[model samples]
Target: MRNRRPVGIWLTTVLLSSGTLLLSALLAGFLAVVSFRHGWVRTSPLYGIIAFLLVSAIIGTLLSAFFSKKVLNPLIALIKATQQVAEGNFDVRLEPRSKGEVGELIRNFNRMAEELSHTEMLRSDFVNNISHEIRTPVAAIENCATLLISGQLSGAEQREYAEMIADGARRLSTLSRNVLSLSRLENQGIITERRRFRLDEQIRQAVVLLEPKWAEKRLELDIELSEVTYEGNPELMIQVWINLLENAIKFSNAGGPLIVRLSEAGGEALTTIEDRGVGMPEEVVGRIFEKFYQGNPSRAAEGNGLGLALVKRIVELSGGRVGVESRPGEGSRFSVSLPMENC
Candidate 1:
């Protein structure tokens, strides 16, 4: 496994050499025939041979230079760019100048570099967000503990500080559990623990579970569900409904409308959760499902940003797809579609 010469250079040299030899032989034969017809070869055979050798040498050198420029230069540039990428320089890109396969290769390499750069940016954002999320709760808990340790407060003050500490601890616990769940779901490729369950009942249960929040806001509920039994992991599917409903409850304006609907058509089940909330712009709607992507800065403190990402991953594992629609002032509508057949 020793390093060999570059294939482009080697192949180009071989082809050029073969072509020069064949062309030179044919030219020399033609020159000899013409010279014999003019009686020149008989008188000056040595001079003629010298001239023919010089001409062949000059033509071969020129052809070698031309072919090398045409073929090997792009390959050399591509090799250097590849080395840069291997060294973690995802910004490197090559200009596509050739046709056919070489052009396609350059285009694909450029696209790969762009994608890698985007992924790197996302990774950096994830690290920063997680650090902020963890640090805020930790700082709160530390402050509350310091206040409690002072032992200079009244009973009511002590209880308040203890409650603050508990709340911070609960936030930390929830963040940790969500991170673990999202990590597990991201790595999972398929849904298991399948069972036949009433999809409508599951949605209803999820709504009931979040009653406190929507009740506090006094939001109107518009529920329309058809009896549809779905075969999938009940535990995971329930999570999807809970997360979606929670999101709707979290963002809805006070006394606004919250709509939940489940129906079946064309051998597929469609469930949509719509909320009259402070909706997102086009850009935020597009990236809302990405891990740790919280588009609404004003409401970022309510939860860690892994809920929607987990919901998306679980739905996909169950052989379904999810989508969302929203406008700036209008509310958002999240739709999940699942195949009726067992998967």
Candidate 2:
């Protein structure tokens, strides 16, 4: 059984019941005083009735004023605040003045408002960032196409323009694919198509797939894999490895050492990707998994900010967690822990 607090409803009920009992006692006492001062036998029944009516009216008015201030006022304020929230004013907050249920209600209202405000801010940022990401590539492709159609460039210049166009198209394609994949993953609650596969082999394959990028940078690879077979969505798990590896490669300094390690501990497959690149501060590390959040502005052009967010959502759906440790200029290490059993 849940231990429930005896606040809110119980307090309100007690206050109202006590007020009613006190009012009744006062009314009875007033009638008794009138009857004793003027003899009950001598006083007219009409006078007694009139006195009772006056006393009842006055007491009722006082009680009404007291209850209105204590209960009705806060309720009215809450209604107005709700209206404001419905009108998209997420910034509205209520001061909790009353105790018991009304105070708890006001506190909840304030918390809800704060959360809605944060969500609204994130939504605005996502829209602005995505718009900029799409527009830049689109504009580049348009310019390149226009230049190519002008027929004023030499053969070498024309080829350069064509390559630029291709690059822009590729960026747009990748952005679209990432956005769609993230949307799909966000809606997914469980990983499907589970099967046992060699997790080590998958990581190795991802590294090999990005050979061109890492090779171009002359990055030294140090991989240590312990044989581990895991049951989960192979397609989605592969994306996790690819994205993390790509991120490490992109940030690594030229000819720097990139390390990949996989091992099993306590029935969890732990994988770490460490890169000798520009590490982030604590603040950046916290918000790195947020959608459209880029910690390093200088390297923002390399990719859209959806990669890590996708990695996080995928790992979570697979019943695992991903984390990172880094300090400024010392390099960063990303760790992912997945359950070895079916989740």
For candidate 2, write residues 3-102 as lDDT tens digits.
3343564466567656765676567567856785778735665566566656775676578567756776787788778878888999999899889988
Query: Highest TM-score: which candidate?
Result: 2
**Which residue pairs clash in candidate 2?**
none
Q: After superposition, how far is residue 210 of candidate 1 from its true place, in Å?
A: 3.1
lDDT (Cα atoms) of all candidates against the true structure: 0.87, 0.87
**Model 2 off-target regions past 4 Å?**
1-38, 281-283, 327-330
Q: Distance from true position, residue 113, model 2, in Å?
A: 1.8
Span of ten consecutive residues with least summed lDDT in model 2: 1-10
- lDDT (10s digit) by residue, model 1, range 6-110: 786768777887788678856776786689778866856556756776788688768877777777777877877877887789999999998888888899989
Model 2, residue 127: displacement in angstroms?
0.8
- Residue 283 shift from truth in candidate 1, angstroms: 5.6
